[model samples]
Target: MRQALLLALAALVIVSCGRRGPQPQAVEPQAFADTTPPSIIYPAFGDADPHPWEDRHPGHYPVHGLDVSRWQPPIDWRTARASGVSFAFIKATEGGDFADPKFDEHRRGAQAAGVPWGAYHYYYFCRPAHEQARWFIQNVPKGADLPHVLDMEWTPHSKTCRIRPDGRTVRAEAQKFLDILERHYGRRPIVYTTVDFYGDTDIGRLPKTEFWLRSVAGHPRNVYPRAIWRFWQYTGTGLVPGVQGKVDINTFNGTPEAWAHWKAGG
Candidate 1:
């Protein structure tokens, strides 16, 4: 009886050793399939100058990116990523209460495509700065990979808010908005402005803030003289792959190494 029990125990041990534990479940292939509208092509223009700015200005900065809103069609982010798009800025909100209709979609698309993206809020001259800041914070969630931007441009011709506040008032309002966003995002927010608004509000004199300047006619040095800039929006009528129609194109001020540091939140 003892011998039989020993043989049975040895058999059980052998069976246990031979049997394999649960195998890992097969991973589903990532779905990078292009589902964008047929109107949106991988290369919007064939045998054409996709990056006119680069052609116009030879030997310019290597890193280039785009800014998009609801005005753009559904984008094939994978194609854009493969076509040399390093980063993106998605418009999230406007004024105090209005949110961009395509904000969520663009944000998600950029993330899934492994692109670093940030959000920007369009400032409304008529709205209170604190209220607009609160609205932006409520709408745009925190922990974004890129720093937030306050798009401060002239509303002189705006049908909604044409009141151009004085320089002091504008600076105060910008400071209020920047303070709120910095506290919420835990990083200094960038300020975007056109030449007219930058001059009107003296945004260059603003303390301890980087600026994204719009200089379509020429380089920022000629347009925004004596002012330091981090990003430069060179053209609004830019042609890029995976983007429908014309889009805004921008470049970083520093080398690719500096961009890596900035993108890493350092």
Candidate 2:
């Protein structure tokens, strides 16, 4: 399999960041094609403040990955790949003008390390959905291994654009964004959201796309009730080698074969 070949032939390695002041340049990872993960790609990761699972744990899942942005910087992607970082969703554009500084670097590194990577846009209420979609398309390149994500969550603490539309308006806006991205990228975009937003906006009613629910305290079935999900963002305080500070950890809700089939766009 492609994943086995990449894992066996490639020796992903990196230099850990240990400085206090200016962050040093990361060792460039060797080129490797992004492919479906090997069977049972166990997550070799940790959490700063671990949540006790009363039911099925994140580790029980066969495939695991992470999401990162400017907040978790100076990552050694090679080391992360070696530590079973099967896939990654890197934050790209937000609103209209805001772009992530580390997006290009993160995407490249993840690709080179053979980690399937995609970009995500943080939904901003102020901007028009089409404008934000265009902005995201302008930034994140095509041909990402995984489908891109639209992070739809309420930002009440924002300095600008804190307005919360009703569920109908929210779903309409989300569908517009999803339609634009699906047409542009040739893959249906996934929705990443929090419990509160899911409750208020009723975005679960959004059509024809998978959901990546953030339920750190418990399983999605427990938190999201009857809603089905593809990915689960279980923790934000995750720790892994090569990545500085805490990062978001997630799990795929399927077996190795199922994950491979999904990655193949089956």
Candidate whose TM-score is highest: 2
Worst 10 residues of 1 by lDDT: 27-36
Which pairs of residues collide in model 1?
none
Residue 165 miss distance in model 1 (angstroms): 0.7
lDDT of 2 by residue, 1-266 (tens): 99987775554422233325666433212111112333333554789999888866777776889899988777898998888788999999899999999899899989988899989999988999999999999998888999999999998899998989999999999999999999999999999999999998888877676889999999787888767588889999999888999999898877677787888786
lDDT of 1 by residue, 1-266 (tens): 99999999999999999999987533212111111232322232222223344222412465677889999999988888888788899999999879999999999998999888889999988889999999999888986788889999877777778788899998999999999999888988899999998888787767868888898767666767667777878778877788878888887665567678878876
lDDT at 243, model 1: 83
TM-scores for all candidates: the values are 0.78, 0.83
lDDT of predicted model 1 = 0.78
lDDT of each: 0.78, 0.84
